[model samples]
Target: MTERSYNSLLSTGRIAGLELSNRVFLPAMDMNLCVEGEISDGEIAHYTARAAGGTAMVITGTGAVAWPVGATSRHQPAFSDDRFIPGIRRLADSVHAAGGRLCMQLCHHGKTASVDTADGRPQLVPSLLEGGADMSALRDNPMDELMRLATATHGKKATYKVADEDDLAWVVDQFAAAARRVKAAGVDAIEIHAAHGYLLSSFLSRTYNKRDDRWGGSIENRARLTCEVVRAVKATVGREYPVIVRVNGHEYGAADGLTAAETAEAAAMIQAAGADAIHVSANAHNPFADFTDGPLPNTVAAYREHTKTIKRAVTIPVVAVGRMLPEVADEMIAAGECDFVSMGRQLLADPDLVNKIRAGERRSVRPCINCYVCVEQNFFDGNPKCAVNPALCNEKVAVLTPIARAQHVVVIGGGPGGMEAARVAATRGAKVTLIEKGGRLGGTMWFSQLTTPANAMLVDWLTHEIERLDVDVLTNTVADVELVASLRPDVVIVATGARRGRPAIPGAEMPHVLTGDGLRAVITGDADADLGSIGGLGRVAVGVGRAIGLLNDADRIRRLSKVWMPVGRRVVVIGGGLVGLELAEYLAERGRLVTVLEEGKHLGLPMAMPRRWTAVRKAAEHGVTLVREATPVSISKVAVRYRVGGDEFEVRGDSVVIASEVCADTSFADQLAARGLNVKVVGDAANVGYIEGAMHSAHEVAREL
Candidate 1:
């Protein structure tokens, strides 16, 4: 019940003359929940949840300044016409009633306007599409995923129209008109979308704005159009309307892009043009691969370095927008780095993030595992759906109604899925018991902290919730029909995770080789049973780790593993999918030479597109060799031989780890079912869904129960 302090983050703040309740702002992230440029009721509900959750300011996703002419999708709301005002008004009123201010981000999708492409109209741009977009990452994309996007596009391709003076005039006029509509609709403020690779931002990119006219060339000229739009928006909305300009703090993966210096200069110009505040964001030129580098970066404080520069350059308040965690945002504000922070993905991960922070239950604020699952839908012009929070798009899912009658619930695993089922069911008045086979609560999730550290936050939060709910938890115990029968549970939720085993291959049983569970066992000192799989050195490492009690702390194990892991200098991983690729990169970072062999053409098939691209890019940067279409033929103590096409080659390795050969495990569920027990299976046990699938599946079944 102790309170956590984040004074600066929770303090009241002002933009222009408008006072907000707190410094936390929800920056514009497209949910694509609009109907032909009009806000849908679903979109309003999504915003209202966040607003009621206690976010001081909630900004709508980009709304087209000129409707279909300047939209990227039919679902993008429009502010150009009066007909869209009613939807805007409803949204504003709802957010206001929920005790939060609302801001509309006015946008005009320029060269990237797919809606224009679909309608056979040229997308307006500062200049024609030229070069500098690095799309090499697209090669790694699965053909089926790419083809689906093509199919969604209705077979139309983008055509561009370089803007002339009149076209520029029209663009500026549209923005002004849009702001007028927003202000009249009772929105608290206006945010002009001049960031990302959108219309106004295209003018700022030196590579794209090749025009010799006033709208292009020098920094001032390149910024002229954006500044003009800011001035027009300010003029239209009146001087004290709290206008914010979202400008790219930096652009990645493109030549002649908005450098840090250029961005600072542009911020000054926008300020001079009467923008009340600056909303700093970064952009990646290549949408395919570089998307994670900006707009939706995977890194923490993704825009902080650039945001600091712009904050120093401008007298106005600066809002930092990339993955702004509460603690980081609070520290940044205290350090005078920025005035406000936008918790975009964090908001999606947990709508009540602000409420949790206000209640001093910061640890209870579910952390976004930095998985790109939410933004992945944007590639297909689809609405945002959070992997961690199933209630994101549908706010009602988190509201657990009481069960019809009092019932005892037995959750047969302590993994995320099992834990979630117990939490939800217990919250709904069910007496719950969580049973785990391992000594600890988190299963693969606890071990996953070694590579993806963010996952540890979720494990910690769920463990805290499990404890807070007073759910009976039994660890270091095996589940069986007898156990459930003893509990006499009315409902049994089985989340026993995935089934994994050693792959059958030449020399597969070599002492130097480790299977997935074998590696985990060695790390956790559970290798007493799997000692045959690891070499003598690994066995010694495990004993020493457990003797010193290092195996009990996942974080300690992760940190010490970097310096002294039992693995060899040269390691080969047997799968190029999510687990294998991430493990390879993690090992490479710790100074181990790593190689990953995949029988398939692509790596990380089911991982979200942005994360998949980033993993592939970073693995290469870390000197990890990824061999596609390579099927392992044999494994020796010294090397792993694999075949790519007709030729076979060997990758030298001191240790080989098999990160593949996993399947769904429903044995326990089947056993319980045979005993006439009311059973529902979830997580990897039912199907190989990993964490996201586990959460969703558990929530679905638990809700029904």
Candidate 2:
């Protein structure tokens, strides 16, 4: 925990002649905050927040070498002409004044350039990609999302112009010119993007580049385009200036995809071509399902091992790009695996991550949760915002300045939303008291950790913040009109969460049938198991375990579930919403024969696109039977009868769980409001946005009180 322990992480790093404050670099992430080629003030504020928060170097999202010609997204930053120099200069000045360096990423989104397609231009490609990415996963997206993605290109057709000898020369010159423009704008460094299925990366990919010319075949030949770009960039900026080339460490989901050995060879070739550093990244040959395996990976320390492979191949500094925790990055650097580490999504979740780690306040740093909420916005060309941190692109609105008068605040319920409100209110010099009827602070979110482990970090963080801010917390105490009136609270917030109703089916009250709440109670030991539902003497054993408080700890219960659980071996989940699908997947993974009956066509509708796609695919892989447009008829002791297409079907299951159809419950808030008390509803109690909605509503309400 001492400063000396993080010597390598906090140590000064040099890329060519440029000196960085530390080894932590903000990876290039497309925020879609710009307009055409112009950078917005909000965009500058976003980078300025991170730079000021203690990032050694902040890499700007991909700046198109030719705006609207080879641009992927309509809102991506552009440095193609001198007209955009002022915006780049402004960002550079702001970042430099904030005590951090600035690096601009030069990109040309070859075959996937949406702007080019919209503008009726033939996009330049190394060789026209034979087939497109697997887009079957997108079928799970809602109708609105599908339409938005379709019209994002403005209803234009795409055409390709294969790059010939003359075309290659033009591409190289464009990159050199862009590099010159960036240097004129006083940018500290330039990162040549040759990863993530971009223009140069396609040439680097052996499978994508099928030309039999000098620009194809061998790995060295296939890497020629990227190497030339690196050389041209180095020449344009001169030898003292930094030139970092980002290449894929490995390409996933392709038989002939670029491998680690190929990438190492490419890195060496790039270094020989006058590149000062290599930023190692991975790419998914298939963008839909394998995306989590690539550029914006969901795994912790995803590209850590790949960097070790590339580092051994090049004398130039190696930059590792993926999700790297502070401790893991430090250990990676200390072991001479990589020189710099990029924490992209983590920094977006909490800009002060570096400062927090530097101050030994790592516990206070907010977690990203890998929810992919931010990534969902890019499909619609909207600026990205964090699920937990509501003030990502709107930093000014996040000011926590104290109010003129101190007031008393009371928050009903101790869920994520309630606890967040309490934390924020207390921070703004208000007296906050949080009351919960349950014995534990976290509501259902604690049990949600059974399927989503990342959620635990969020609950832990909010609890820490609540305690740190000195908000009075009362567990096992109910919030009522009498109790709240006695406290004399100036403002009250109700975050009691959603309401659930069991399906109107025959034999709904059977002892073997459990509601979502019933399942939670049984798993957390908040409610004892029904003897009628349990087997002979095993029922007695479960009751004794609950009575003795052995099931109090969630982790212990999760561990015990693998060996023993009160639920039956076969499970039938009603309603294929987020809860039902996640529960189905979780149960299936635990060796249960699970079947989900959904009245609607979609599954995981409430989740983000990437996570939803993953959940559906994984559920299928785990052998979960999904029946759409199905209405439950009745629940027998052993089988569940349902109707799919006017035909009756019966599926045998030992236990049935109803986890569908949620509605907003504002009865408590309405009662408090009718009494003339300032009342606000947040989280699922107001709407069902899950964690993102909870955090957003909490921030909005807490800032006012």
Candidate 3:
């Protein structure tokens, strides 16, 4: 086999006093695996997997340097005292044993600290902003339960006690002691969390810091606290120990915050303060700032320019991190943009990405869809998880163990759930055959690919793995009781996916109205043989769709959707769930005036908050009208009549699309069970949760087999 070319990123590198195996760094991301401020075994396993996967270095997620007063989460690891040293030591040793160097990120949440965690204690800020928790960087998060509770404490504003001169000194000392404790625990480096509008970042922020003391005012004065913390850390850990400073390349949320130019100047000052390396990250309070949404092309390498700008201003190695792809990171390094690349969600999606790239199997590496499930789930008190990779944080629970007796498995359906079931069973030494009634393996996922480009990438990955495993894949083949009995399979998995339900409305059967799946089938030439259901205008839509000349190919559909959407000049999408909201964005972007009618109080149900917020925001930006709590009563050829609070309103549109709930089909599994054969149901066939649910359910059922 020929060696894979990733020379720029795979080259050995040095940061401060430590020599790294590669230029890739796993940037700090909170896993919420700690128990009562102590590192749990789950957290250790989480880090160890990444280390063993061959990442050059790992930065442990943000740990509190000042507990209670500056805690970001109740479960966040702490290094404020000597008591945390033992747990820190075990974590360090595990990473070291796995052939990876580990660094501890020391942080003080400051003004952004959770009010619930602060309890009756005063939340510390650089200056006492009037809003306190209401004005906190974390206040924008819609998924944070703690933030919701804190926001609910109305009447009186969330209290804040501005850090005085004594408090600043005390914080500096706390950081210095944390650095000393980490050094004692054999940590390779200590990264001061000075980004993300945290305590130190609030002081650095021109938008937040209004202090006129030595620690605030000018750029030099505002950055003084961060510089002092860096100096204090170096003094305790010694000049030779590597200390990384994570600074924002651009604070998008702050109106007067540091731009690239200001950030470069700040970076130069940080290096001058004896810091070893600069880890460049961006976004202050915006939840969507860190993880860019997938589907669009512009979000690729979103933060490389920031790193390139800062690299020229400082002598220390700059680590650039954004929604960077492996090839993009390599090219950025080759172009001398930055010395290292840091991956957060990418690593979570597949820790073995580096290993796969090294083995010339880069195509097999799972991609991070940038769905923001990790950040969304974490803030909701759940451990981080990847939509594509089900075994992300729940590594121990999702492990695939070999069965005592290898049996023949027949999986009905070629969707994500079925594909995953086949892959797992085959890997566990079972003879597997996957049958799909559709011509393709991806069920509704092909339609999903049209909405989000990353979902198309996921289909590519899933199909490739199924093929690589040598599983028998039979497309256009329906599985019934007779077929399974002929094969005499010991186990049968039915993942026959979900179907979009039709609502009972006056014009529901009108030819002008189309189901979301019907629209997809028309686009891909997978429509039913009967053209009558589409109506007279529907035939025109199909003809125009066929003229685009796309088959089952997702890439072509995606390219076509960008320029040519099948909808009319005016479109109204009913049911503003994930599919409806996404389709509205898709239609509106193609010059169609779109309106989304949802019965639910919110758009994008079942989707995580970050993704929902992003999709809804993008739809609004594209001029897509959203009407919540609107029940569709009937549809006319030229308009849609929906009711809200006993008031009927008509939305004029040329075309109406039904993007409603999907119902699971368990008839296949039920029939198989009746025949006295072992049967399992997964994915939409069992429950309709889209990708995350499908993959997770598949993994769970397949593991048992």
Error of 3 at 479 (Å): 2.5
What is the C-alpha lDDT profile of model 1 across 262-321, one tens digit per residue?
Answer: 899999999999999999999987877688889888788988999999998999999998
Q: What is the lDDT of residue 344 in candidate 1?
A: 93
Per the 3 Å backbone cut-off, how many clashing residue pairs does candidate 3 have?
Answer: 0
Give the clashing residue pairs of candidate 1, or none. Answer: none
* lDDT (tens digit, per residue) of candidate 2 on 1-705: 343356788889899999998999998988888888888898899898999999999999887898877998878889788999999899999999999999999999998788888888888887876667778888777788877875647767689998999988888999999999999999999999999998999999987899899999998899899989888888889999999999999998889998888899989999999999999999988767877788678788998878899999999999987878888899999999999999899999998888887887788899888888888788676778789999988898678879679799999988889998898889999999999988777787887877887888889899988999999999888888888888998999999988877888887788778887777755666642234544555556567767898767767777777777678889999988888989998888778999999988788888877788888888999999988888899998999999988799999988899988688899999889888898889999999778889889988999976
Candidate 2 residue runs with Cα over 4 Å from true position: 1-5, 527-553
Where does model 3 exceed 4 Å of error? 1-3, 115-117, 130-157, 286-298, 527-532, 535-549
lDDT of 1 at 328: 90
TM-score for predicted model 2 compared with the true structure: 0.97
What are the per-residue Cα lDDT tens digits for candidate 3 across 1-705?
565599888999998789999998888988978887888998899888888888999998888897655886767788878998999999999999999999889999876677333465666888865442222323223354445434412212445778899999999999999999999999899899988878898898887888988888888998899999999999898878999999888876556877877888888999999999998887644554323422111277777777889999999998988877888999998998998988888899888878888888887888787677777665555577888787777778545778779699999988889998898898788889999887777787767877787777778888888888899999878788999878889999998888676798899887767786667655565643345555555567566665665555777766675675556788889988888988898788778899999987667766676676667778888999999889999888899999999899999977788888568888878889999999999998898888888888988888887
Q: lDDT per model, in order?
A: 0.87, 0.86, 0.80
Colliding residue pairs in candidate 2:
none
Error of 2 at 360 (Å): 1.6
Instruction: Please provide TM-scores, in order, for all candidate models, with all chains considered together.
Output: 0.97, 0.97, 0.94
